[model samples]
Target: MNIEDIKQRITGFSNELYPFAHALIPEELQAQQLVIDGISFLFADKDCKTRLFDLLEVTEHEFVNKEFFDLKKVSIKVIYALAKKRFTQLESGLDINQFGVFYRLGLSARAALFLKYKFGFDADEVSEILSLSRIEVMTLTHESRSHMVDFIRPVQEGLQQ
Candidate 1:
């Protein structure tokens, strides 16, 4: 495809990928770079969603189980089963954004939440996008919501004070 065709094909996809990359990667420039890398793969990867998965696998991540805790322990209990690394999201520092919860989740969970919540994708679509079973997508979303409740409670209570 020509440059214009490629650009037209990937138009709205970069917008989605950048935020997802930003959620996984803290640095704005780094996130943009990653999305650009993903976009560059448009010629190779047939689908935008597939490119997203490729980006997810390649990004370096800190894998810590329950590593972030301040005054109270806000553990993503389900993560223990998955041995997923803990993360400190943009608002996980209690920065007060309602959607910050997505930043704390594992890759699958975060992607699932983003696709489902941000794109209005249903479980079936998310399962296809993330390459997970329907049940797995459901479970990941459940865990994401649970993690939100688990962490947000402490921040909310503190904020109310």
Candidate 2:
């Protein structure tokens, strides 16, 4: 693929994962930053899916604002090498909102949900990416599904909205 094409694909895929990012951070701006930084740093040589898993695994202390790998060309590197942007606003905490509910889940559990439901990876694939056994992925998926229902359902008159 051409340089532009690959960048475009990466950006598009990153946007598709924004909701997951937002849920992970519970702040729209920080989530956007994750996507932006991810696009800037993706290695063309590395598998995109594995890179994405690495991204989610990055803790705040591990975040690198600069690009390291360009898939190879300096031209490709230049295209994605935009200045890093940071949002200084106070990020939201876990509350009753959809994002908050999602944030309450352990990071691995949340990743398991997004990997399976959002990205359509089967348990085997998720296990490989997450470094968990197949059984653990299955269990995480099951528990995450059970938790999702309460927050996802419509609020009845008698229940808390």
Candidate 3:
């Protein structure tokens, strides 16, 4: 199939799999486009699919038995993660105008890291790994850490409530 056809299929599948995911995303337009772009990349390249599937497998394994958490909350957490990462990368970056896209990227990066460190998947195993360069990976790592810190602190504070 052509790239457009593959993107369409992937979009349809994503909507079905994560029906609430779109709404939870910060930037609607960018979020939608990212999904389309990811699918298009997967369709046009076999290696990309392998990497994506590898990451997916890792996510599934890590989250399989976890308690049910609000997807929206998770989405917010993911966005925060991405935003933090992007900001660090840009250092002098402005606020993310495309919240939806930012959230999606964060989610993707989180899933990728979870798979790599949490599930023992090597960086080379997953598809189109988010950080192909040292700088990108470092930025992502810092963002992910910040996201986690922000995410957990709230919960800790809530428990004292």
- Could you say which candidate leads in lDDT? 2
Q: Which stretches of model 1 miss by more than 4 angstroms?
A: 1-12, 45-101, 154-161
> Which residue pairs show collisions in model 1?
64-85
CA RMSD, predictions in order? 14.2, 11.6, 11.6
Whole-model lDDT values for every prediction: 0.53, 0.55, 0.43
lDDT by residue (tens digit), candidate 2, 12-49: 65656566555445566766766565555455435644
Give the CA lDDT, 0 to 100, for residue 89 in model 3: 51
Best by TM-score: 2
Candidate 3 displacement at residue 85 in angstroms:
13
TM-score of each: 0.54, 0.56, 0.32
Candidate 2 has its poorest 10 consecutive residues by lDDT at 79-88
Instruction: Give lDDT tens digits, candidate 3, residues 87-125.
Output: 455433434444433343455565555545553545443
lDDT of 2: 0.55
Q: Model 3, stretches more than 4 Å misplaced? A: 1-13, 16-25, 42-122, 126-128, 133-143, 154-161
